[model samples]
Target: MHFLLSMFPSSIHPHLHPHPHPTTFCCRNAVLEDLLEGGTPKPLKTGTTIAGVVFKSGVVLGADTRATSSEVVANKTCTKIHHITPNIYCCGAGTAADTQKTTDLLSSNLSIFSLNSGRKPRVLMAVNILQDMLYRYRGQIGAHLILGGVDCTGHHLYTVGPHGSMSKVPYLAMGSGDLAALGILEDRFKPDMELEEAQLLVRDSIHAGIMSDLGSGNNIDMCVITAQGVEYIRPYQESEYSDQRRRKYKHHPGTTGVLEEEVVPLKLEVVEETVQRMDTL
Candidate 1:
């Protein structure tokens, strides 16, 4: 009972047989345990696309407008970007609910820390608190956060893994669609990019994710955190992207339509004979 409780205290089982407590975790975990000991196979939850970059001025964050459940696209307008403090923002990946709960928790902690210290918390301080909390619950809290901000310490970006690992980087991309987006960032991101250029890069990266990764897409939500404050960009609508495609594939100069050439129909008798054969079969 103690061992089981330790595995997932608030989840799994808190009490063994001959006790009154009930199982609180998913039956999937039970099946997983059984499989580890020679039982069966099953599944897991997967979702989102989140990206962040540190430009010459500050940090820029963006994500796709999707929330997913296994193979299903749950919400087309779900946002993965969360603002935890006036100067700080988080790009969430993995479980949406977990990400929301963690960011809200971080916001509360930052508030308390600010009140006690009589000064705003720095980026690292906030990341430290988040990493520590993540380490405590670790696997139970299924959120990977890209924490970015402008602080007295200067502009910064950090990736806090779902399992509590933390690292500072110039830029990062995470979630199911990360691979495609990260490739774009790696190829084109520059250290001297201004806020506007950085936002473009973020949008293009998310666009790449939407094109190649099934779990990502809808609209692109973006924000830039600088010395002044967080600047919110209008979300990129899917209809706009579709318009771009239409413009790209539309008729070019000097090109004539098939109708202009006078499209000729095949014999109607041939079509009727094929339909008659199919009906007889």
Candidate 2:
């Protein structure tokens, strides 16, 4: 894999220099960090929120839909939990272009491997391939992915970072919002979490991240993967979420979810204002 990264010239931007080395993938699609002559870019806001949790039944992956370019929220509804195959899905974080390309690379390789091997590759196999691919690009590509699925090996979850680091974890969160999301998962995640509970847990975790992190929100999308296959839980609208807040405070006041305070647990009454505002809708 190192040999592949070595193949590219040291130059991060292949297009601007017209170097002897063949064009890098980054050349075709420019990265946000590129210093274009005199124009200074707002510190590349690749902030995103992606969470993956492993349970006895299956894996649950979730991400927020806000994509930022500098100060601009580029897309309000970008899909981050990408379908790699029927049994495989990846949660993309970091730079949007790199994440998209990385998933494409993984999906394409898995397809080709399945065609040649006469069988679908397992989750670990896919992770191994992706680790190698990421290793090859290593420092050149800034992308992060939380790969999860139910292969023949049962449920598996892996996080791959641009540094080419791979770690098998039961639950993880990545992106600028990860610090906030990780706090929730650390406090409540369990080995025996049910599918429905896991879905709600992930949703709540994403909300905390979005609430506290500068580049994490707008909407939420979740991908639940079990032996039955993948099921997408659509985005929760602001109105619907506010309504949920009221119900949660009425039904279960102490539990985690949208009602939880951003940094600490607050009185459920704090949400009453938002609930009142929602009445107009």
Candidate 3:
């Protein structure tokens, strides 16, 4: 009878099975695993423009506040510039907290080692550090950074993306409005642009971005970082530039017509024929 009972499986067999309990430890800092898989959604704020120009003097970095969430304006005068090293500056446009944390980590790490090293960090070293930090918390949270500075040689600029992708250029911009701003900058930029010209280029680039990106706004804050020191130009209203562009490109299609002298005006019959062919196609 005991042998027959042993051969039969019991309903409570799972309880009789041996299992080990999990050991938990005190978590000293915020763990990414919890934030990602613990069912807690992260809060975020959005809006910013990152534009920079490399001139004979050095690099000029520009960022605007005018952040917007769901087409609603959020904050004005939100800063995006951080001093990674004495000569290097990092500016970004994206999640405000993540970007700020990137700067904070860099600053804290540098300060802790400054006494022993006795040397200011370089832009490349700072960038590698930032890239690794960003790589950790990379999902759905990242910053578009523009790192600019003067090394021992001269002015330099680099655009860095979320996944540690970076590229060097004489000038660089990153944001939703980059395409529009690039159109304006491409036409205006010279190889070795001077300080005054660089200022105008930066302003014009921001102005272009303002027209295209609803999230970017407010008066333009232009900064000149050269061999001398950092100079923050007074903010100027964008409306002034909008009015000027309106005057330049303003055209009345139905009324107050202005025709290009270079093109001979086509008659109504010619226009009708072209429309007929387009319709057929």
Candidate 4:
């Protein structure tokens, strides 16, 4: 308190101050610092690159295949794109299991709804369900998703966060590599891009993320949603960053000479025995 008062002009008395002032440092940071000092900090488990775009005729969604847990790469070719319905697809980021189960739940709900209504489910319906579920969880679910689809209304693209916040955008990126991916999307995206062009753009965006972010790599996957149907492409592009082995490490069986061979045999005693069968009533 004295130190804070010293910063003010000596001409004005301390009691003469008009009102109380907020602290200069954030309370959250102070609490975090105390927690860190008390124990070893664990690395957060997160990684992935996912993006979506709305084109003239349909929607294109892209994702990288890498999954990371803290500093370790958990899966090299894991699928991030998930199917919600025939027309709606999602690209998930954050905790792998969380995203997988969340999408599975969405798919199950949408499927049931479609069956009861005798018609296809809308994209907005899926989005609403997802947001409500996420909101109820209060960000504990740890799933960030990019949803894209085509329904009777039209082509749609949305980004849904773990906290239930959502945004409708023509193009959007998510995950640790989102910044890098968004750079590519923002630079070349067009309103009326053709199917092929939109696909290529999405592919490039994911590729950019893979190249720039350690959390995103392995291969690229894409999903295209059109009025006719949905097309899911697993491994739309392979990662060029992976290095091929110069020479095969596997050697022929005879490559190494056998120094010596020893065979041990166990002596066995054989006995013949007969067992009586029991009569059933």
- lDDT per residue, candidate 4, 35-118, as tens digits? 568553454858898999899899999999998877898889999999888899999998888899999999999999989999
Ranking by lDDT: 4, 1, 2, 3
TM-score of each: 0.72, 0.71, 0.66, 0.74
Summarize candidate 1's per-residue lDDT along 89-187 as a digit string, tens digits: 898988787799889989999988888888877999889988877776535667989999999989999999977899999989998888998999999
**Collision count for each candidate, in order:** 0, 0, 0, 0
Candidates arranged by TM-score, highest first = 4, 1, 2, 3
Candidate 3 structure quality by residue, lDDT tens digits, 46-139: 5566689988778888766576765687766666677776677788787776677778778788776676798756667767776666554433
Candidate 1 vs 2: which has more TM-score: 1
- Name the 10 consecutive residues with the lowest summed lDDT in model 3: 20-29
* Tens-digit lDDT track of model 2 for 30-123: 4333434434344466779899999878999999998998778899889898888889999988778878988998899889988898886899
Q: Top lDDT: which candidate number?
A: 4
TM-score of 3: 0.66
- RMSD per prediction, one decimal? 16.2, 18.0, 24.2, 13.5
Q: What's the CA error at residue 173 for candidate 1, in Å?
A: 0.5
